[model samples]
Target: MTTIVFLHAHPDDESTQTSGAMARASAEGDRVVVVYATNGDHGDAPEDLADGETVVHRRRVEAEASAQATGTQQIVWLGYADSGMSGWDQNDAEDALHGADVDVVAKQLAAVLDEEDADVLVGYDWHGNYGHPDHVKVHHVAHRAAELAARRPRLLESTMNRTRMAADRQARLDRGEKVDWDPSAPMDDGNPLGSTEEEISWEVDVSPYLEQRRAAVRAHESQGDTAWMRSMPDEEFATMFGAEYYIEPGRTEPIEKGWPFRPPD
Candidate 1:
C-alpha cells in the first residue's frame, strides 16, 4: 500500500486543507499520516478550558480527534510553538515554528519520511496558500525534507483554487450575500489567497469523503475560527470544500481531477 504523508501548519489546518484527501487515501487502503508543525499553542483559547489547562494541551487533544476522524493512521508533531500571525511578536519566539531553522526542521521531517517510506509528501504551496507565517515555513520544510529523504517521494503542494474561489465569491455577491475575504486581495504575507487556475496542477475531487472531512473539522471545536465551517450546511460545505487543489512543481500539463498518490487519466 502507498504511504502518504501530509504536512500541516497547525491542528485544524489538515481539516480545512487536506483532510478530504487523507480520508480518500484511507478508504483506498493506503496509509495516511499527518505531521503538524506546531501544537497551535497561540490559537484562540477555549472558554471551557479547565483551570490550568494549557492551550497546547487542549489543541493536542483536538488534533488527535481530528486525526481519528480523518482515518489517519498516525500523528506526529515537530513540537514547535505557534508563531501567531505574520507580524505578531510571537513570530520572534525562539521555539516559534516561523523562526526555526529550516534545515533543522527539515531533517526532523525527513526522518519521518524515511521511516514511513512515504510514496508522496503533501505540503502547502509557496506563500502557504494565504501567507500565514507558519504555513509558509511548512512549505519550505516539506520541500527540504523531501530533498533530504533517502528515497525521495513525489512532492505535492496543497493549495486553494483561486479561480474557483473568486467565482464562488462573485456568485455570493450576485446573491446579495455579505462576503468578507476576497481571494484576489492581498493576504497575510502580501500575496493573494491561493494560486490562480493556471498555476495549480491538480483539482482533487474529495466529494465522496466530505462526511469524514466535516467530522475532522468538527473535531477541532476548541478553535473558534472553525466554528462557522462546522455550522455550514452539508451542501454548502461540499460546494466550498469538495475539491482540494495542489501544485506539482515541474508538471507542465493541464490541471486535472486526481490526487498525489494516483496518476491522472
Candidate 2:
C-alpha cells in the first residue's frame, strides 16, 4: 500500500486544496495521513463559540469531519499557533509561529513522516495556496523534513495551472458573475518554485471524488459559501477546478505528459 502524507498549514487547508485527492487515494486503499502544522486559532470562530473562546477546539472538530469526509486514516497536529497573513497587523506578534525556527519545525515533521513510513509527501507550493505565511512555513518545513529523512518520500508541491485558471476565470466572467480575477498575480504564474507547467510531475483524476471534495470544503465553515458552491452543476465544478495539482521536488523527470496516478501498468 502506498502511504501518502499531506502537510497542511491549518485545519481547513487540507480540505480546501486536496481533499478530493485524499478521498481518491483512500478509496484506492492507499494509507493517507493529514498533518496540520497549526491549530488555526486565528481563523473565524463558529457562531456558537463564545466571543472570547479560542478556535482550537472548534477547528479540531471541523478537521475531524473533514478527515472523515476524505477517508483519511490519521490526523496529526504539530500544535503550532496560526501565523496570520504576512501583512496583517498581528503578523509581527511575539506569539506568532511565523518566525518559528525552520530546523525545529522540520524535526517535528520528520518524526511524523518517519512514524508513518510515508511514500509520498504533499504540501503547498511556496505560495501557500494563497500566500498565507503559515502555509508558506508549512511548505518550507515539509521540504526541510523531506531532506533530513534517511528514506525521503517523493515530495509533491500543490499548485494551480495558470492557463487553466485563466480560462476558468474568464468563463466565470462571461457568465456575468462577479469575479475577483488578477491576471498578473505572481502566485498565479503556475510555478510554485518559479518553474513552469512543463515541470509538473503528477496529476490525479479526482473528478470521481468531487462530491467528497465539496463536503470537505463545507467542513471549513469559517470560510467559503457551501450553499453557493453546491449550486454549481457537478460537471461544471469538476471541469473548472481541479482538487489539486502537484510538482515533484528535485525531479528533472520529463513531465509525465499525462496524469501520473493512473493504475499501474
Candidate 3:
C-alpha cells in the first residue's frame, strides 16, 4: 500500500478540497495522512460555542471528526497559529503560520514524510489557489519539504479546473440556472482563482466518495453556514465536485480522468 501525505493550510481545507481523494485512497487500502499547518483559529466563531471552548479547540475537534469521516489514517498538526489573511493583524503575530520560517516548517514536514515513507505528497497550488498568505506559505514549505524528504515523494498540488468552472457557469447562465461560485470574481490576492485546465496534470474522479466528502464537510459544524458546496443541489454538487484536479510540477498535460496515486507492484 502506498502512503500519501496531504499538507494543507487549515482544518476544513482538507474537507472541501482533498477529502474525496483521501477517502478513495484509504478505501483502496493505501495509507492516508493529513497534516494541517495551523489550528484554524481565525474561522468564524460559532454563536453557540460551549461555555469555554476556544476557536482552536473547537476547530481541532472538528478537524479530527472530518479526518475520521474521510477515512484518513492519521492527522498531524504543525500547531502554528492561524494567519488570518494578507493584511489582518494576525498576519503580524510572531507565531502566525505566515510568519513561520519556510525552511524550518519544511524540515518539520520532511520528518513526517520520511517517517511515513510517503509515496506521494499532496500540497496546495503555487498561488495557494487564491493567494491566501498561509496557503501560499504551504506551497513554499511543501516544495522545500520535497527537497528534504529522504526519498523525495511524488508531488501533486490540489487545485481547481478554472476552465471547466468558467464553461459550466456560462452554460448554466445561458440556460437560466444560477451558479453559486464565480471564478472570475476578484480573489483575496487579486488573482484569478484556480488553475486553467491546461495547467492541471491530473483529474481524479471522486464521485463515488462524495458521501465521505459530505460527511467531512458536515464535520466542520462551525462553518456550517458558509459551506457553499453543501448548499448546492445533490445533482449540481455531484457534477461540480465529482472531479478533483491536481498539478504536478513540470507535467505538460493532464491525464484524462486519472487516479493520482498508482501503487507500486
Predicted model with the maximum TM-score: 1
lDDT of 1 by residue, 48-124 (tens): 98999998999889888988888899999999999999899999999999999999999999999999998899999
List the global CA lDDT of all models: 0.92, 0.75, 0.89
Tens-digit per-residue lDDT, 58-137, candidate 3: 99999889889988989899999889878899998999999899999999999999999999999999889988999999
Pairs of colliding residues, candidate 1: none
State the local distance difference test value for candidate 3.
0.89
| Model 1 CA deviation exceeding 4 Å by range | 262-265
Better of 1 and 3 by lDDT: 1
CA deviation > 4 Å runs, candidate 3: 178-181, 263-265
Task: Quote the lDDT for 265 in model 2.
Answer: 25
State the local distance difference test value for candidate 2: 0.75
Tens digit of lDDT per residue, candidate 2, span 131-221?
6788778789989999877668888887665555666678888999998755436542242322245656655567778889878877877
Candidate 3: pairs in clash: none
Model 1's TM-score against the true structure: 0.97
* TM-score attained by model 3: 0.95
Candidate 1 yields a Cα-based lDDT of 0.92
